[model samples]
Target chain A: MEDLTAVAVHTDVSLWGLFWQAGFIVKLVMVGLLGASIWTWGIILDKSLGFGRAKRAFDRFEQVFWSGQSLEELYRNLGDKRTTGMGAIFIAAMREWKKSFEKGARSPIALQMRIDKAMDVALARESDYLAARLTSLATIGSAGPFIGLFGTVIGIMTSFMGIAGSKSTSLAVVAPGIAEALLATAIGLVAAIPAVIAYNKLSSDAGKLTARMEGFADEFSAILSRQIDEKLPRT
Target chain B: MRGSITSSAIIHAALLGWGLLSFSAPTPMDMANSESMPIDIVSDVSQLQKGDKKAEKNEKPAPKPTQKPQTIPDAQNVGDSETDVETKPATETKAKPVEAAEAPKPSETPVAKPDPQPEPKPEVKPEPKPTPVPATEVKPEPEPKQEVKPDPVAEAINDVKPVPAPAETPKAEPAPQAEKPAEEEFKLPEKVAMPQAKPTPPAQTAKTPDRKETPEKPKTQTASTPSKEKDGIADQVADLLNKQKASAGGAKRSTDQASLGASKTTGGSSLSQSEMDALRGIIEGNWNKPVGAEESPDMKIIVRFRLTQDGQIDGSPEVSGTGADAGLLNAVKSSALRAVMRSAPFNLPQDKYDTWSTVELTFYPGAT
Candidate 1:
């Protein structure tokens, strides 16, 4: 918000004296635009942190859970805390596989299918989390120029009218006003560009993490399937 | 002896006096000539009738000789008077000749003497009338009457030639003679020459005053001419106003005729043509002609100003309109007031002091 405020002040002033001297109304408009942009930026930061934490946690959980710890021990240590990380997905899949064996419906294919389903659900949930602030960011990205352009259009209209009313032809007469008018658009883009770039990067990163979770689920299924095949009667 | 010489001297003096008196009136000059001719007649008659009739001649010569005896006492009395005393002698001389020639001619002398001699010959008649022999000639007074006009006619012919007639007759005659010269005399050269000299002063004034007064008259005339031109400022301002209006483009919806002065207004206003042109120029120079400004035709700005007594701006402008820019509004309001103040005393119509005292300028960019 502060940076946005600074940008606003800098842009408004450096643009033209008129923008600098803009009235309370214009200041309100600028403040509103900046406020919106700052809000969107905050959402972006929050979503980025949340998504990064989830991806990092997923990776850490994958590494530790697959480090050859005993399955029963891993389950015992998952105590009370919602172990709804990638590690939790592995536990859920294993529990489902054992229940299916006890039900006499156990097969390598059925067990792998249960693990993939649980992993798919986990990946879908993580993907939803990762994509949280993106919609707002997309909105900010697409709508910013239009908002800025609205202010610019207003400012230009006002400047031209002033010229006509004053009957002035000097560039000095028109430039400041026009510059003030365009400031809103510039600020809009300032908010929008970063949002667009961050959103794209976060979305692509979320896709990669989802793909890794799927691959992990596939490998976990394969190991479980081999273990189940070794224990089965040579049928 | 003294009496005879006196008689002879009186006879010569009388002849000369009658000659002068005869010519005094026109009638008497012929009468005197007749007397002289009669004297010549007697001498001829003395030679003819006397030589032929000796008794008649003796009688004529006897009366002539006795005429002298009777004329002798009268001649003494004639010599006492001066101007006419000399005419008495001529009567005596004519009387003597009358008796010397023939009795008939001698008898006719007294008749001619009464008519002619009363005016001219009377100066000589007193001398001759005293004789008893001429008393009978005086009784035949009809002959004097018959000889009156001839005497004057003959004397007039002899004494004054007709050459002097035209000159003195026209002078003496009252008909046209005196009248002609009076008119000529009325046209006195001096009276005419006096007015001719009098015209010079006015002519001199006409030339000299026009030149000398030119500089002076223009000073007074120009002082008034400018104000009058100032009053006419609006008409002069019309063209510049149009330029200002056009520069406003569609910004101004409409224009109105703002009369500078309504009552007793001058032809010129505070905004002279030149000043308005200057203002228009300023506006044109500054304005870019707003595009789509006319989209809203109802938009307008009415700025009102209050000027101090000294023509300085007294208050902030009150503005009302959609398109009014606060800065522009402020500047224009202030500038208008400053212009009014700078123009000091606002060259407004003096008579409309109340109306223009605090002006409200209505500028509508989108009037129409």
Candidate 2:
């Protein structure tokens, strides 16, 4: 920053200086790019943190389920509060299985079908949560450079107009405008690159998390079906 | 969502601060001017200054030594002859400074005659006597003094109090050329029959300061008649003469304009063409070109003026125009001058103060 300011002192070519001097259209492009970059980074952080939390929750929920605790007791432990991830799938299947007993239902086939349907709906909801905003990341990553190019085009066009008005094709006249223009493209790329990389990494993490939830749902449903057969003896 | 936004803001601030701390903008180092040939206008202008200087020098030596072909064998035996040396070279060289080699022989004798006018003019012309600057200043300081342009230069030299007893007589000649044989008008004719024994004028600078001040008018009128427009500086020399006519003594104006041309020879560089044209346009907007005033003496006027940091005129500017002897040309010169004057305190870029602090503007009045 010391050197940055030193250069500015000698010649006013600082970033802020460029922004201030830029034409209205270029300024608009720069501001828009800035917003996109911030939004991209926000999405990246959210998805990364959310995926990590989901994985940790799934691990804890699986450990509790396999700890030989009674299903009813575990379901009670969920306290009827809104559950998440693998736990939501477990709660949904358990409630369905409990409802069969309360209604004095006799057909194991119908009760089993209802429990599986409940788990499937919960799984789909979790999947939707994991996949949210991923499309926006893809859009920004693909479109960032083109937005930057638009700013550059506007900047260069304005610089040419300056040249015509000045009546001299000297490099000094054109350089500042071009530099200001290029900064827009540079910002666009800066915003885009991280968004693209984060999107790839987080999407993979989310998929792994979903796969774990699906596996847990299958194992819990299998346990319930086995318990039902033993309790009634299928007689 | 809130957490992510806060995280993004923190990350961005950190990134920007770090980038700012580490990044440095690269500055351009000094570079060469791309292939256009650079003109050393000072040398070019000075080289052209020699012709007008020649005609001016011829008049100074004529009033004294009114001898014509007298058989004074004794004076002939005295190999130290002022006439035999100063006259031939004055006419022979025209304006070529090559004969500056012979300029040394008369250094002692020409010292007195050359002292009055050319002395102040050199300091004033910003090296006005381009009569081989090195040779003239080196051989006889007075040789450069020999080119004192305006007749008022004679009075200014008399004012500087260095060389004059007979220099004053030459000063006297300018004011009443009739009283002194109209030497300026007939200076060419006189140069042919010239006996150059004018050493008597150098000693009287102290005696007739009053007599010299009295004679300035006619001398300026006569000075205007003989001035030849050579290069851009020629107009300045004429302007210096005319300025002398206005000021009663051209000496003060010359010294004020010279100021060592210090501002220019420093880190100052020429303004880009656009800058030059803009400056010219601003001045030209105020300039009213004379009708049919489109020739060498009238078409061009150059004014070299100093500017303060705030872009106000620093002092009275030095102005020169060609063929100032004619009334129309004189009007053209003054009108061009009035344009520069009327356009007060110029608006130049501030960051380029070093380059524009002192500007020498060559104005083409009738050009597109």
Candidate 3:
């Protein structure tokens, strides 16, 4: 009777116990979820850092862009090496402008168009870089739960099998399996929740940053166009 | 960027430490929950005996017919021998020699042969001698002292036979103790007619009382002879028996009620334990722990709620706690609440309303 009571009493199923006791498929599911969760956290960390750095660098570059220095001198000071997000776009547009002047393309419209095209291309490339690996976050968020559920289902199935084999419907018999199974879903959610939230938050931040770059590109092209208008004879 | 990452790492490390700490902390609730009741074997045995005696007395009068065939003949033979000796003693000379020779054998047989074969002869003879001796020596003081001496001898013999016999004839022993001497006189015929109607022994020494009653009554009543003494001793013995029966019955009844009360309380309490476990199992079973919840083991939600008598959740469980990220905390809390809500109407005992009416359960996923 004491043994039975003990069996009945100490029915608390520990998490490690659950995982260790889980079947092959469930264990695989749990491992997969854990991997996904870890990867998601890594992505979150990397993206947040990258976005913060890009935003700060953009702020610094904007300060220098508007420092009222000669555009030629500023471009020269940037050197041949593309330094930052905004600098790279500025360099691409200026380099195309300088080339047009060297080639003696006296047509102001054509010069303005070339500079805009170069800056647009640069903006697209920078946007791509900012948006990189964001899809992984979305994927983890959406798929993590399902993977966890799959593990849970397997764990529960194992528990039912145990119940059938043991021929007793006692909680002690079934609690461990059920707890383990739930751990899978839990891990999945753990992996998925942050990934989902991070994806939403970071994607929007990235989008806003990309928009600012496009705005800068458009503004830079306008300045070049204004310069060409003043330098070329009236068409 | 480095500072933020370091902070995040520190936070994760702290969470990991907390989880480890919480995991290692032993839950005291498990010890509180598994309680055992101690059973008293001695009290139980005594109560059982009392119950047995009460039952025997209550059902005694009804089963007289079954015992009639076995005990009636012995009683009749006893009466006939008593009468022969009593009536012949009046014809002094002729009866004296025969009575003297016969008297010593009866007295000696009881003292010498403690066996069942000589029981009938000794029992019959002892009754007549004690009656006549007590009547002749009317000084009640000497008579009782003399009676007390032989009474123990008779009791010692009866004690051996009575153990098994009382089980079969509990009613006979006590009735014979009260009325055996008086019935040997004019009431002999009636005693024979209702020979099976012996009352149960009030005490352990039922046969000794019978032997004692025969001598005591004859000495007490030389005037009215059988009538007054018969009523006096018979009523006294009867009253004593009734009082004993009443007291035993009362004790047995009270103990019965106590046991019933004990069982009811234990039964209710035990039922609640299982009900609580069932509730715990269902909720825990449904809980899908959020990933990384183990990292923040301190993130616990205390869910308090009331349950109706019929086991239905009376109100929504209120979740209150703070730890981890909002998204993570909310996910864990909602999942915990959802599990409880999903497994609605817990299997609570209706009779034990006070125990489970309100519950405050702590949901710490990995710890549980």
Model 1 alpha-carbon drift over 4 Å, by segment: A1-29, A98-108, A231-235, B1-368
Docking class of 2: acceptable
Q: Tell how far residue B349 is off in model 2, in angstroms.
A: 42
- lDDT string for model 2 (A84-159, tens) is 8988888889889888888876877777789899999999999889989988998889899999999999999999
Most accurate candidate by lDDT: 3
DockQ for the candidates, in order: 0.00, 0.36, 0.10
Runs of candidate 2 with Cα error greater than 4 angstroms are A1-11, A233-235, B17-25, B30-368
Which 10 consecutive residues of model 3 chain B have the lowest summed lDDT?
Answer: B38-47
TM-score (0 to 1) of chain B for each candidate: 0.18, 0.30, 0.27
The collision pairs in model 3 are A186-B289, A186-B291, A190-B291, B171-B198, B171-B199, B171-B200, B175-B199, B177-B210
TM-score of each: 0.34, 0.45, 0.47
For candidate 3, the lDDT comes to 0.64
Winner on DockQ (1 vs 2):
2
Model 1's alpha-carbon lDDT is: 0.50
> Cα miss at B25, model 3 (Å)?
7.0
Give the number of the best model, judged by TM-score.
3
Instruction: Report the error of model 2 at residue A23, Å.
Output: 2.1
Cα RMSD for candidates in order: 57.6, 26.7, 23.4
